[model samples]
Each structure stands twice: as structure tokens, then as C-alpha cells.
Target: MVKTSKTVGRCEEFTANDVEVLGKAPLYQGFFSMVKYRFRHRLFAGGWSEPVDREMFERGHAAAMLPYDPVRDCVVMIEQFRVGAYAAGCAPWQLEIVAGIIEPEEVSEEVVRREAVEEAGLEVGELHKITRYLSSSGGCSETLDVFVGIADSRKADGIHGLPEEGEDIRVRGLSREQAYQWVESGKIENAASIIALQWLQLNYRKLQEAAQDLPLP
Candidate 1:
């Protein structure tokens, strides 16, 4: 008998056409909707899989931004109470990058810019895209478009949020090193914050040089 190992590669052999969505039905509809999908996909070595039923939470999409003041070597972060964290048995108050849901037909950059002001009381300068990622691909239909926006950290303090929306956000400025340290120490738990800070760590020098070319505001 001989044992063989499968080769793992960067790209997969399967595409959407390989899967069939038999039917979809709404399970719950509220602030965020839930739906049940019946689908089947191609198997790794051969034929199709058995019909599968999965429930997916549909929260739409969102945009998140980490406000970096390259001139001051600081990053602005927001702290707020999140019900999701509380429900998950973690600390309710989370330190996170500014974020907001993207409404229909709204540009990602515009959504981040608006969220920056509403959540952190800071007006971002130039926008540098970081990445777009799914929040939870397994069970949620929420993709987040993340960015590192040039901002003035000096103006990032104070509590700011829309009262009508029940948001009470506290803004703080942290040195870039301290922010990254939080990521390393698990003090920053959200994916968006972690991704943004890690990216800034990798691209700090280039971002600083780019900031030098902008006119003083």
C-alpha cells in the first residue's frame, strides 16, 4: 500500500458554477435578516455534495477606517459598547476602528468618512485603502471595506455620536507603537482594528513619506 499527499495551492479548482443553490427562504427579518439556504457543491475528489441547509445572517456590508495621523505618528481609535461582544461573554466596551454600515448605492470611502466624523469627531484627510474582507464568511454576509485614512490625531478626542442612533463613542489617540502593541497583547479584539494596525506596522515608513508631501492643514 502507498500513501499519497494532496498538494495545496494558492488557487482552488472550484468556482461558483460548481455549486447549485437549490432554494433560499427568509428565516428572520429585523434589524438584520436571517435566511436559510439549501445548496450543494462539488466535492474535492469527485461528484457533488448532498443537499445542505445553512442559516446565514445577512447584515449587508460595511466600511471601516483606522484614522492615522502620519505627521504625529499617532492613530485614532474609538471605544464603544457593543451588544454583540456582551452577548458573546466578552467585555462589552471594545476599542475599535471607526466603522459603519454601507447603505445602498453609497461609496465605501464616503461611508468611512462619515463614520469617522460621527464616531470619532475627526475629519479624515486622504484615504488609503487597506483591504476588503468578510466579517464571518461561514455564517454572515457582511463584508467590510477597510482603510487607513490620513487624519489629525490632535482633534480625535471627546465623545461623539448620534444620540438618535443610541451611539456613545469615546475617541482616543494612541501612538502607533502603542496601538500595535495592543494588537499583540490582545487588547484590540476586533478584526478591523487588528488588520488596520498590522497593515500600518508593515507600511508605516511609506505612509509617513506620503504624508510629508501633503500641504499642511
Candidate 2:
């Protein structure tokens, strides 16, 4: 067994240069790719550790947004099928925020806005970034940028998403309180959805205040 020291501070002095990559190669390529990396890093206790091999899933980074209608105090959410959940022996369909991969040359905000339209049939305006996080740093290289966008929830009832992409999304509007309730009840299970909703819960009053002068849609 290995013992480690506990630290009180959040800041670490390690840099990317502290890790040395001896080799790397593609393990598989499909809708997503996997790569194997052999590397060693400087240890917190002392010297460099033994070279290690790890496989990384490379699905690319993504952007997700929760559309909030301040006038109605509602939020737009989407339900869609996710293979990962099915494989994990959980429910196949997931309640989630609008999200999409950030394709090459595209920005995170652009992806969020486009996904809102594609997944929910709703147009979003004035995105406020919530936070950015890694999906799973241990095995996946994907990161997600989360945001809250201004929208008119009355327009968000439909079945949308591109047929060619095998996407079938159901869009619905829920009161902000109701949505946060889902988060508390385990109904909203996905990370992006949970994070976005919690952020909304904490910052919604400020958002409502900021939108007060604007005319209701």
C-alpha cells in the first residue's frame, strides 16, 4: 500500500513539463477514438514514478446549455437516448440539457447555441457560462463547458433532433423549482444537467434581476 500526504492548499506547482510521455498510439477509432499513453510523472512525495500505461477515450470536448425563461420562471430540458447509460445497466433514456460536441474550428458557445436549436427546437440568447469540467479525467479526455441561456420556454414543446444522426429528442418546459426538484430526486442524473441546474438554483435571483428591464418575450 502507498501512503500520501494531505495538503491544505488547492494550488499545485506541477506543470505539464513534469510529465514525460514515452510513447502513445491509437488503440481504436470509431464514432469515438481511444488512445494508449505511456508516461511518467513527478510524484508529490518525491521522485518520478514508474512509467504507466493508460487508455484514454477521445470523444472531443462538448458544450451544454440550460435554457431558462425568466419571464415564466421555467427551464427547457430534453430527453434522449444515451448508449453509455444503457451499457451501465441504468435507464437508457436520459433527461439532460442541450449539448453537442465542439467540432473542429467551432467555439464552445457556438456549439451550445446550435445544440439548443437542434435538440430542443428552441433558440437561445445571451449565454452565461456556468462552469467547465472534465467528464472523467481518469479515462476520458472529454471536457464540458456548461452555460445558462436566455430563452422563451413557451416555444419549447416538440420532438426534435436530426433524423440522420439517429437522434430523437423530446423537449419540455418545467418550472425552475420543479427542475431543481428533479436534481434533488435523482431524476436529473447526467453531470451537465445537474451542474447547470445547481448553478441556476444559486444564481437565478441575480439573473432575474438582470433581465428585469428587458421586455418579456
What does candidate 1's lDDT look like per residue over 54-144, in tens digits? 9999999999999998888999999999999999888799999999999999999999999998999888888999999999999998999
Model 1 scores worst on lDDT over the 10 consecutive residues at 1-10
lDDT of 1: 0.90
lDDT (C-alpha) at residue 89 in model 1: 86
**Count of backbone clashes for each model?**
0, 0
Candidate 2: which stretches are off by over 4 Å? 1-12, 215-217
* TM values, all candidates: 0.93, 0.93
Compared with the true structure, model 2 gives a TM-score of: 0.93
| Cα lDDT of model 2 by residue, 50-164, tens digit | 9999999999999999999987889999998999899987679999999999999999999988998899988787789988999999999899999999999999998999999
Candidate 1 residue spans exceeding 4 A from truth: 1-12
Residue 202, model 1: Cα distance from true site in angstroms: 0.8
